[model samples]
Target: MKPKQTLSWKPFVLSAAVLLILFPFVYLVLLSLASEWRFPDLLPSYFGLRNWATILGSEAGLLESFVSSLLISLSVAMVSTTSGFLISRAVFYHPKKNTLTLLAYFPYILAPVVFAACLSFFFLKMGLFGNITGVIVAQFIIAFPYALLFFSSFWNKKVKSYEDLVATLGGNRWQTYIKVLFPLAKGLLLICFFQTFLISWFEYGLTSIIGIGKVQTLTIKVFLFIKEANYYYGALSCCLLIFPPIVLLYFNKRYVFKKLV
Candidate 1:
């Protein structure tokens, strides 16, 4: 009876927690859609799809920014994830990998804006300033550290055990990777790729600094709208910024449930 009671409460508590966490996003959607949501009111005075419709249409260069954001994020994800996976493999197999892993943590600890400032001079020298290619490269700086960290977790004894099993079955390193490692880590790899994409997608400081305002990502667009006191469009852009993360959350939840099942 006691165990059953505890189990029953768990679902209720988790559901409440999930809703509590998601309420802000719900509010943001309402706020974006609310044409005149004045203060001291629990609900909006008026509600319409005008914001979404406008943002999706030819208003404020949003369509262009949306496409640019997509392209940059996808490109950053693939490049960063692939390179991180390759480099992490080498580092993980190295005898001094512990030291290397410790070093990798250093770069991510700095605030991105500050890091961007530090790299600005070098970017100028390399003629990467104001370049979309440079923006990708700058964003990679943030994504790569996270990528290395993520891939590191996938390289423990459990993975090593499989490697050993493959070796025993007469497989070399490449065969082991193609047959065992890649297959086993495919789900994790996909997650890592998307995580990198999210990082690049939301990045503002690095892109602004490196691209020198030439590259206008959705994040930049959001800030620009906010700077102009256009909260409606800002909220609209905010929706675009957050939508992918929600999709990502759904993917992670589904993946976890599948693993559990």
Candidate 2:
């Protein structure tokens, strides 16, 4: 007879964790639509669409800030993902994989504030201060590690066999990568793109310090509003800021779960 599987606590544990994670998101949605939110109420006194309308209809450059964030984030995602893929590919195929992997992971291990401070000096000396290009460069640096780490792991495991098989079939390295390796890595690449996008989108300190006041992102806008006690509007801004990542994840839900599992 086949052995019976034991009933495990894993399902209960996972269900609890899922609910814990989702509780905040459910609360945020509630708060965003709340018309009369107050502390000690345990919930909003009233609920309406006014908060969403006020933000979506406002001329406070709210839309521009959204557009700016999208543009910067997409730019950072594309550049970092592409650059990281190339760098990780080089490192993976190098004779000294451990050494190169260490180099790739170093940036990610550093403190963000410390890294931003170091980058600030470089931007100042290079006359790149207070510019979008400077901000993009900084975001790229910060996002590269995430892309590299994800792609590197996927490339090593999923594409290694195909890579060697292609080599044995007389295909050159470049052709093999384009036709074989890249296709297998596409899902992970998409995941990295979304990850890098979120990193750039929510990043505040580096963008603020590096871009000064000339460049404004959604995170910076939210921070400013909060400082000025614009609670309702700030909540709206925070809701808008979270939409992109939510959308990205929604579309990539299958791939995300596959990777996680």
Candidate 3:
């Protein structure tokens, strides 16, 4: 007869950690599907798609908010990433590169609320207040600098050598970027876009202050739901919130990270 096999604790530990991480998401989904899930209940009194069905009508407005947030975040990410990549190259070759790089951190020097307060006057003067455009521009201000700093590290001595070699091979400045630089920095660019997208997606203080409560991104909607003590709607909104990031993560891991590896 064989001796009894010992049970390994590693699997149990990993399973516990994974459950801890996933519990909030699972609870959110369940809560979104539930009604009358009051205190002291091991399970919800009712759990179905009733709460989710609200998104199909004007009652919830979550669908609109989700679409608005997606558009704003995608715009901010694309603009910030492209501009940051192009401008950082110029900064890399500037006489006062360090000074300009230091200036890139200016937006981060203040809390988002204070930063938004300081910019409110200009936004109002430019007729950007209480609108989607204003929210995009405001988020850009915060995300752009972050993208700038992120891509700044991509321009270094090795990149310079590649640029020189490209020039030697009869490549123009544009050709060097299109052929060599862009391809080499493909992974970094995708990562930066993802980061900037998340930054804009979750931005609240600046969005609220700059938008003057008119622009309702998902983040703002989430807070509104919580403030009203509507847990069902809040959980539903949160489910919508994490959906985009998870998709991005899946694509990044499958395409960008695979190529990177």
Candidate 4:
């Protein structure tokens, strides 16, 4: 019965961890909908949809920023993941792998703020400062490390023998990747896409510094609202900003959780 007892503990621990992670998000939702949130109070005295309504109706640039954020995130995710996948594949095929492997993960070792600062100077020199393209480039750099790490694991484990098998069947390299390797790596690719998306969406320092007044994103707007003491509006805007990733997470939970387990 030791195995049975150990299994029982697993559910209990997992439930506790889930609740711990979700509690702040639940509170954030409550605060977003609340008419007023006072610190001394355990909970809001009144809750209404007024906050959501006001932001959605009155805010002019919020939707634009939301779209910009979505576009930037999607673009960064696609470019970084694709580049990382290709690089990882090349590394996998390389006769000497260590140097390429090190290069792939090098960006991740740098602090994000430091990297952003370096990029800011480069952008200024290139006259790309305060531009959407500049922000996208920075995000691509940030997201590539995560994509490389994730795809490398999938490629090594699932596709190590793929080339040999494809050669035996008289298939070329491209055909092998397209038919055998890619299908097996789909789950990891999805995971990388969403991971990179989140990183780009929530990125504040880089976006603010690089984009300046030109390319506004949801995170920048949220920070600006807070600085202006528009807590309600900020909270409401945040709720809208949070919805996309939450929906993605919900839809991908089965696959993501299975991998976690």
Best by lDDT: 3
Rank by TM-score, highest first.
3, 1, 4, 2
lDDT of 1 by residue, 225-253 (tens): 88998887888888888998778888786
Clashing pairs in 1: none
* Lowest lDDT block of 10, candidate 4: 1-10
Q: Model 2 has how many clashing residue pairs?
A: 0
What is the Cα-based lDDT of residue 149 in candidate 4? 64
C-alpha lDDT score of every prediction, in listed order? 0.84, 0.81, 0.89, 0.80
Better structure of 3 and 4 per TM-score: 3
For model 1 the local lDDT of residue 12 reads 92
TM-score of 2: 0.79
How many clashing residue pairs appear in each of the predictions shown?
0, 0, 0, 0
Candidate 1 residue 36 Cα shift, in angstroms, is 5.1
Error of 1 at 27 (Å): 2.2
Task: Report model 4's TM-score to 2 decimal places.
Answer: 0.81
Which scores better on lDDT, 1 or 2?
1
The superposed Cα distance between candidate 1 and the true structure at residue 254, in angstroms, equals 5.8
lDDT ranking, best first: 3, 1, 2, 4
Candidate 4 residue pairs in backbone clash: none
Clashes of 3: 0
Candidate 1 runs further than 4 Å off = 1-19, 36-46, 157-174, 254-261
